[model samples]
Target: MSDDLGFGKLLDDDGLVARLLGKTCKGRNRPLLYGPDLPVVFLTGGPGMGKGRLLRCVRDEFGRHVPAAHLDCAAPVHAERAAQHPSTRSEVTEALRELAVQFGAWSGDGGAIGVPRLYAGLVAVAAGDPLAGQAAGLDEVRRHDDLLPKGSFWGGVLHRAFRSYLAALAALFAAQPLATPLITAILDELFERVSSEGKATLEDCYGAYSGAAGHPRLGLHALSVDFQQGGEGRANAESFLFRALREDVEAAYTSVRGRMARAGRPAVLLDHADNALGRRLLRPVLLDRESGHHDRVVVIATARRADGGRFLYRSTDADAGVVTSWSPGDGGLPVWQRRQGGVPGLVAPARGALLVGMPTLTTEQQNNEVARLQGHGGHSGAAGHGARSGTSGAAGHGQGHPGPAGHQPGEHASRLRVESGIHRLSGGRPRFVTRLGEGAASLRAPDPAAFTDWDLLDAPVRSRAEPEGRPVPVADLLLDDLVTRQLPEELPPEQHDHWLDLLSHLSVAHTGACAQHLMQARQEGRDERLSAYRITELLADSGWPQCPRHFIGDRGLRHLLMRRLYRLRPDGAAWQEDHELLRAHFAARADTGDSGADEPCGTAGAHAAHHHLAAGGVEAAVDHLTGAFPLRDPSRSMARWCEELLAVAGAPCAAPLSGAPDDRHARALGEAPPAGGDWLRRRVDRLLHAVWLYEDRTRPVDQALTGTWRPLLDRLGEEPVPGTEVLTRTAGEWAQLAQERQPLKPCACTRHLG
Candidate 1:
C-alpha cells in the first residue's frame, strides 16, 4: 500500500531487529529482492529480535516476483491438521509421490530428468485405517489442497511427507525469475523444539542436496533463536548440517559423474549467539574459513562484545576483514579499532556481502523514539506533562553523555557521536545488546551497572589467544539459579541435586563413558549416579535447553556412560577408578572396544607416542602421554613426564644424551623394538613386558627370553626398584601360587616323542 512496499520500518531502539529487517548498508538494494540471479541474503539474529517481522516485510515488498517461501521450523503444534491441510493442492502431492516412486525405480540415467523425483511414502500413511477415526471431522476439507484437511489425525507429518515434496520442488526451486528463488526459509528455535535426530536428518537432507557448493536449484536460509544450553545443541545441529553439506557435495558430484552444477550457497543467520548453544553453533562456522571449506557455505552470527570469547572461535586469520580489530594501547582507548587482518576467503564467496556495525541511536533518532513512547500530553513515568516538569536530569534518570554537556571551542568534531561501546559490552553481538538492554530496562535499573553485577561479569574470560582461565558456562549459571530457587520455584531439592550431579559428572568424562558410569551406579542402587532419565528430568525442571533426541542417536547408553565419566576429575584418583571400571565393563560385553571402544591398548599407546613425536620430539611426545595418564604404568608415565621436562628445559645444552654413557651389554628386550630406534618407547615396552614376563615365568621362559632378560636386569640394580614394587609383588604372588616354576628352561615332553 505504500510507495516503496519493500522497505519496512525497523524497531528504532533495537539494532538487532533493525538489522534483521534488511536496514543496513545493503538493505535497500533491489538485487536482494528482485534479480535475474539473486544473491541469497541471510538474515541472522537471536530470538525476539524481529527476524519474522523482517521476513514478512520482504514478502510484502516483493509480492509474486519475490516468490519467497517462509518455513516455520518450530515443531507442529497441530500435526494432524498439518497432515490433512497441506499448503499446496493434492495434485502436486500426487505428482510428487509418483515422482518418488518412479525415481526409486529408475536406473541411474533415467533418474536424472533435469529434476529430482519425489517419494510416495506419505500417501499410504494418509490413507491408512489407523488415521480414519481422526479424519471424521474432515467433511469440510478441500479435496485437492496441499495441506491435510482439518480433524485428520495424520495432519502434520510434513517431514515424513516431504521427502517427495522436496524432490518435486527441485525443478520449481531452480527456475529463474523466481521472484523468490523458490526460497525455503525456516524460522524456529530449532535447538529447542526439534529432537537432535530431526535436526541431524534435516541437516543431512540439506547437506546432500547442496552438492558441496549448495542447492543449485534452491535458496535455503535458516534463522534460529537460541537460549542457554541450546547453543551447544545448536552447535551439534550446525555441525550435522555442515557435515551433511560436505558429504552431499561429494555425493552429487559422484552421482552426476561430475556433472552436478553449483547451486546457490546456503547461509545461516543466528540471533544472539552469546550463550553455549550459540557459541557451539557459530564457532566452527566462523572458523571454517581457516579449515579449508571456503566455498561451501557462509554463516553470520551475532554476539555481544562484552561476553568476550564466548562467541568467538579461532579465526582462520588474525583478522577476517570486516570489522578487523586491533589491540588497545596503554590508555585502554584508541583512535579506532584497528583492522589488521585480511578478508575471510570463502568458497563461492558471497558475490556481494557487507558487514555493518550498528552503533547506538543518534540523538535525534533517540529523542524521536523516546517521544513516541511518551505520547503527546501523556503521563511520563516521572512527570505529568511536558519537558519542563519535575522530571530528573539525565543523571537522575541514569542516562549519560549528552555530548559532554558543553563542548570545547573547536570540538564540533566531538559531537560526531562515537559508538556507545555497547557492542564491546555485548561482544558486538547485536541481539544480546538489545535483549540485555531491554532486560535491564524492564527491571528499571537506573544504570546498566545496577542490573549486571561486576563480579559475575568479571568471573572469567575464555579467549582463543589464552588458555589458562576457566569458562563460566551459562549452563552452570542457569543450574546454580535453579538450585537456589531463583526461578520457577517448583524445582524440588532432590531434583536440583540430581541435575547438578548429572552436569558435573558428564562434564568430567566422555559422553559414552559417563553414561555407563551412571548406569552402573544406578543398577547398584546409587540413585545419585546421575542417570540420563534423572538428568533429563532435572534439566526439564531447571529450564536448561533440551538436546535433540537424535543427537544421542543409537548411542544413548554410550552417551550416559561417557557423560558420567567425564564428570570425574581427570587428575583425581576417581578418574583411574572410572576408566578401569569402563574398561572392565566394556570388556565383558560381546565385543570389547567395538564401536566407541575399538582401539587396542598397545595400539593406542603406540598411536599416542607417534602423535607426540609428530608434534615435535620424543620429550614432547612423552609429556602428552604422561599428561593423559599420570599414575598407572609409571615407567611409561615417567618417561613421558621426563620428555616434557626436557623439551622445555632452559640454559645452553644443544647436545644429545649429554650425561650418560651406555655401559650395559646388548639386550633385545622385546621381539621388535620401534623402527626409529626410539629408546623411550622401547624402555616403556621393555618395562611393561618384564612385569608381564615375571608374572608368567612359573610356566616357562624361552632361551630368547633369557637373552633379553639378563641385559635389561643388568641395567637395573637388584634390590627391586621402588616404582616397580607394585608390579613385582603382583608377579611374585602369581609365581608363588603357580608352583611349577622354571628358569629359562624348555619343556621335556616336546623334543623326544619322535
Candidate 2:
C-alpha cells in the first residue's frame, strides 16, 4: 500500500503537504480570520496526479500535529464487514461505531468518543432473538463496555436486574418484542451516567428524529426500528451517523487540555472518494454543512473526477465565491495571510467543496526527478558543457551535483536534449516523468550524453518491473492508465469496447460538434455508437482535460491517438481519411454565422484548413488559411490571431509522408515543400516548422525561430495581405510571445539546474 501510495519523492520538495495543511488551518492563530467556516476540501486531479499519495503523506508525516485519520472509501473496512450481515441497518450502525472509535482514541485529553445510540441499538437487536443474538448481545457488551462510563449505567442495571447476563437480558427483551421502545429505555438509563454536557449534545441531536421526535432517548429506538424493517429505511439511518460521529468528535475535542495539545480542527482523509460509497457518505455531509451544521472536522477527500464529484461540489456561480487552491505560483504567504481564501461565502449555491489540484512537476522539478531516478540525484544539466538554460534543483531537491565541465565533451548538451524531450512528451506530469525516468534508468546507457528521444518518451516500463510482463511503451501505458482502462468506470461496461474505437476516430476533430460529425458519419449505418454528446461527457467525466477547441482535450492523449491513427495500418491512410472526414464536415459549415469572436479559428474555413493540412492537402490548407487570414477583426488582438493560426496549422503531419494516398485533396500535407517560390506558402511552411520547435518546453529558447517571423514581416512589407499592417505588428508580438513561452538560459550560479 505504501509503495502504491507514495509519490513523495516527486511531491515532497513542492511543499504540497504543508500547503494543504495550511489550508485546513492546522497552525493558524486562534479566532480564524474567516467567519466560522472551514469549507470541506476535495483535493482533485486526473489519473497520475498523485491525489491519494498526498493524503497518505499528510497522515503519516503530520499525525502528531494533526489528529488525522485516513479512511479508504473505495474499500471501506466497516462497510465490508457489515456486508456479511443480513441487515442494511448494520452498515450505518457499524460504520458510525468504527468512525467513533477511530476519532475517539486520538484525542489529546483523556476523553473517549462513543456512539451510545448505535451501541444500545446493536445490543437491543441482538437480545431480541435468543437463537440468533444472545451470544452476539453478550459479545457487544464485552467489546464496548469500557466506552460506557464506569459507575452506574451498566453496574446498576446489570447488577440490579440482569445479574445472570443473557437470561435477564433476554427476559427484558421478552417484555418488549419491538426494538424501538426497549433501546430507548436502555439509552435513557445509560444517558444518566455520562457527563451532563455529552448527554445534552446527544439528546439535542437525536431529539430531532421524527420517528420519536419528543423523547431524546428514542434516537437508538429510531435506528433500531429502521433496522427491524430493512431496506431504504436502513439506508436513511446512515445519514444520521455523521451528526452522531461529529458530535462525539466535538465532545472529545472540547477539553481544555485537548485544545491546548491539538488546537486545530482534526482532518478526515477520504481517499478514492468519488466512488459509490464516497458519494453516499459525502452527499449527506455536503447537505449538512450547507444547512449550517458545522463541526471541528476538516474533510480532505481525493477525487478522480477533475471537477470533483458533482454532488460534493457546487462551483459557486457568483464572482465573490471563495475556493482556496493555493499554489507555489502564488507569492509566498503564510496561511494566516491569505484573505478569505478557503472560506465558503454566501454566494448562491455557496460552493460546497474547495477543489484544489496536486502540482504537476515543473521543468526544474522534472529534471531533478529524472536525476534522482537515474541514480544521479544532483544532475539536472551539465553546466560549462554547453547546456546553459538549466537551473539547479528547485526547492533544494538534492545535494547539488558538480558541473559536468570535465565530463564527455557533448555530455551537457545531450542531457539537455533528453530532459527537454522528456518534459515535452510528458508535459511535466509526475507519473509520466517517473515512468520515463525509470525506463531511462533500466536502459544501460554508457553516459548521459548518449540517451535518445525514444528512450525517454517510449521507454520500456514493464520489462523492468515484472519478468513476464511485456515491454509496453510509456505512451501505451498512458493510454491504458488514462483512457482505455478507465472506460468501464466512465461509461457503461458494455460500451467500453466500442467507445474506445469511436474515440480513436474522433481524435481528429477540433470540437464536440466536429467530433459528433465524424462520429455520426462513422456510425451512420449502425447503432454501435452512443450519442456524441454523451461520449464527450464521458471523456470529461474520465478527467480527459479539455481545451474546448480540441475534441481530445489532453495533449499527451491526443498525441498518442494521432500517432495511432497515422501508424496503425500500412500507408496510414486512415489518418488522412479521418482528417478528410473532418475537412468535409467543417468545409460545409464554413462561413456560417456561428464563429465565436474569441475563436481565432472559429470560422469553419479555418477549421477545414486545419484538417486539410492534417490530411496532407497542404495547398488547400494554405488556401483556406490565406482566405481566413483577411477576415480577422483588426481591433481584436492580431497577435493572438497569429498564435491561434499557428495552433490550427500546428505542426500537423509532423513527419513527412512515405507511401502516397489517392485523394487529390490529400496533397495538403503529403507533398515536399514548394522550392522557395510562393511567399505565403514558404512563410506558412516555416511557421509550421517553427511551431514544432516549441513542443519541448525546457529546451533552449530558439531565438533563431524568432527570425522566421522576421522574414514573414519582411514579406508582408512588400506583398501585402488584407490585414498586412496588423499582421506585421502582430508578427513581432507573436514572436515575443514565442520567446516568452520557452525556458530561457540560466545565470552562471544556477546553470546546472532546470
Candidate 3:
C-alpha cells in the first residue's frame, strides 16, 4: 500500500529530507551560515491530510541514516499542556524531558544526558563551575566550559559577572514547587543583567560563545519581556525555557556531529503545530534568527493551514539587524538589502523555512490503492464473490469467504467502478481511503461494482479488532461526536437545538453560507433574537470556518451532517420545511440584485430548483429550471445541472402539493389533482422549451446534448402519460433539426432518437 501510494516519491520529489540532511552534514566546507541555515521545515495541511503518516514514513525510510525523533502533540498530556494559556513550568519541564529522551536515542547516546542532567548542567554553566553537583562531564557543561580560556584575565572577569546570574537561575530551579512569580522575578533579573548593566560584565562573552565565525551571537538578556504581564506570561516563560533547552540540545549536537559523520544531522519531527505548545515552540526556532541554532540542527514540524500567518514569518528584531542594509554597488549605485539575509533572491525570513503542503491523491494513485486492497488475501474471496453477485445488499455482511488466487474475468470493470465510487466519496484523503479499504476488507460480500452513491456517502469505519456485535456504520458514530464537539458545553439546551437546526439548514446548501444567508436562516426559525454575529462567532470558536463563505470544517463531517439532515424528521416534513426556507431565502437574494457574473447562473438557479422540488413546489421548480436550463448552449456545467435536475425528477415527492395527508392521496387512487396536473405540464413544457431552444437557436450543436437531453427524452417516453405524443414529436423535431444543421455528420442524439 505504501509503495503504490507513492509515499517514497512524495519524500524524494522535492528532496526536502535530502536537503535538510545536507545542510547539517558535518564535512561540508561551506561557511558556518551558508545555504538556508534553517533548522525548521513546516508541513501544513488540514487534519487527517496525512502529515503524521508522512512523518512516520520519513522515520521508517531514513531512521538508520539520519536519526529522527517524533513528538506527537496530539497526546492527551501534550494537549492538556497546550491548553494552558501560559503553559506552566511543569508543562515545559515535561515536554523538555520527552524531547531529551528522543534526542538521546537519535544521538545513539541512550539518555546519557537526559532532561534532568541537562538542566543541572545549565545551572552549573551559569554558576561558572564545570564540576558543580551532577554536571561534571555533561556535554552541555563541557560546551560552556570550552567558551572560556582557563585562568585568562578576561575570562576571570566574565566568570565573576555570570556568578550572580547563575545563582539566581539555580535558586529558581531548586525551588521545590517552582512558583510562577519567583520564576518571573528570576527571569527579569537575568534579562536586566544581560541587556543592561550586566552587558558590560560579559562584553566579550557573546563573541567567545558564538565563536568569531561571523555567526549571530546569542545573548542571555535578549529575551523579550513584552509578554510578561498578560495571560500569556506563563507561555512566554515556558518559551524562554524551551529556547534554553534547545540551545543545550544544539550545543550537544555540535559536539556529536563531528564524531557521527555517517549519521548526518539529527532531524526532530514535531507533529501537530496546530496545538498551542507546538506553536509556542516554533517562535524561537523559526522566528528568532539570532539564536544561531539553525546552523546546527534540523527541525521538521507540522501545522494546519488555518493557523494563519503566525508561523509564516519571523518577527523583526532590532538586535538581529532586521532593517535595510545599504552598500556601494558596482556602478556606485546604492544597494539595499535586508539585515537578516537569506537565500540569494529572497528577502523574507521564510526563505530559510521550507513549507510543504499535503495534497490529495491523484486518480491513478486512488486506483492503485483500491487494487492493492482487493488483492490482499483476506479480502480477495469476499470481494470476488460480491463482484460476481452484482448486488450490494448481498455484500453488506462481508466477513469470511474462500480466498481467490487471482483476478477473475470481468473483475477489472467492477474494481474500476468501486475505485471511482471511493474516490468520489473520500476525495482521495489517505485517512478516509484507509478506513474505506478496511471496511471493504471485512465485508462478507465486497463487490466493487455493487457500491452505490448512497453507500459511498455512508462511509464505514474500521470495526474493532474483535467483533462485539452487529457492526454499525462509522459515519453514524462520528456524526454524534462532531455535533457534541461543535456545541459549547455551557450553551442552553434550547439554544443547542437552535444551533443544530441552523447547521442542518446550512448542510442543505450547495456552497458555503455567507453571513446574510445565515441571518435569513436564523430569521426563519422562532429565534429571531439570536444574533447572527454571535452564532457565527460561536461556530468559528468551535472550529467551523470563520471566513466570509463559512462552511463546516471537514468534508467527512459535512457528509455525515447531510445524512443527519435526511434522517432528522422521519416523515420528511422537516426536510421539506428547511428546503422551502432556503429556497425563499435564495429567491429573495436574487431579487435584491445578488445575482451577478460571479454567481454562475447554473449554481444559483439549480440550487433553488432542488430546494423548490424537494418542498413539492413544482411550479417554482419549473421557474428555476428555466433560468438554469442551457437553452442557448449546453456546456459541461449545464450538463451537470441537467443530470441533477433529472435526479430530482426521479426522486419520490416528499409531500403532495395540495398538502393532503399520505392516506388522503392514496384514497384518491394516487391520481394527480388539478393543481398537480398543471404543475407537471409546466415542468414538461419548460423541458420541451429547452429542447426547442437548443434545436433552433444553438449552432454547431453541442455533443453534450446527446448525453444530457437524450436521457431525459428517453425517461419521458418510458412514462405512460398524456404527454407521450408531445415527447415523441419533440424528439422527431430535434433529430430533423440536427440533420438539417450538419447533414454529413451523424449526431449521437439523432441516433438515439431512431
**Top TM-score: which candidate number?**
2
Error of 2 at 68 (Å): 2.3
Clashing pairs in 3: 39-299, 86-235, 397-444, 398-443, 398-444, 398-445, 399-443, 399-444
What lDDT does model 3 reach?
Answer: 0.45
| Tens digit of per-residue lDDT, candidate 1, span 509-533 | 2234335464555347555344555
Q: Per-candidate TM vs. native?
A: 0.25, 0.72, 0.59
Q: How would you order the candidates by TM-score, starting with the best?
A: 2, 3, 1
Residue 445 in model 1: lDDT: 19
lDDT of 2 by residue, 690-712 (tens): 55444323234445555666566
Top lDDT hit: 2
Worst 10 residues of 1 by lDDT: 649-658
Superior candidate under TM-score, 1 versus 2 = 2
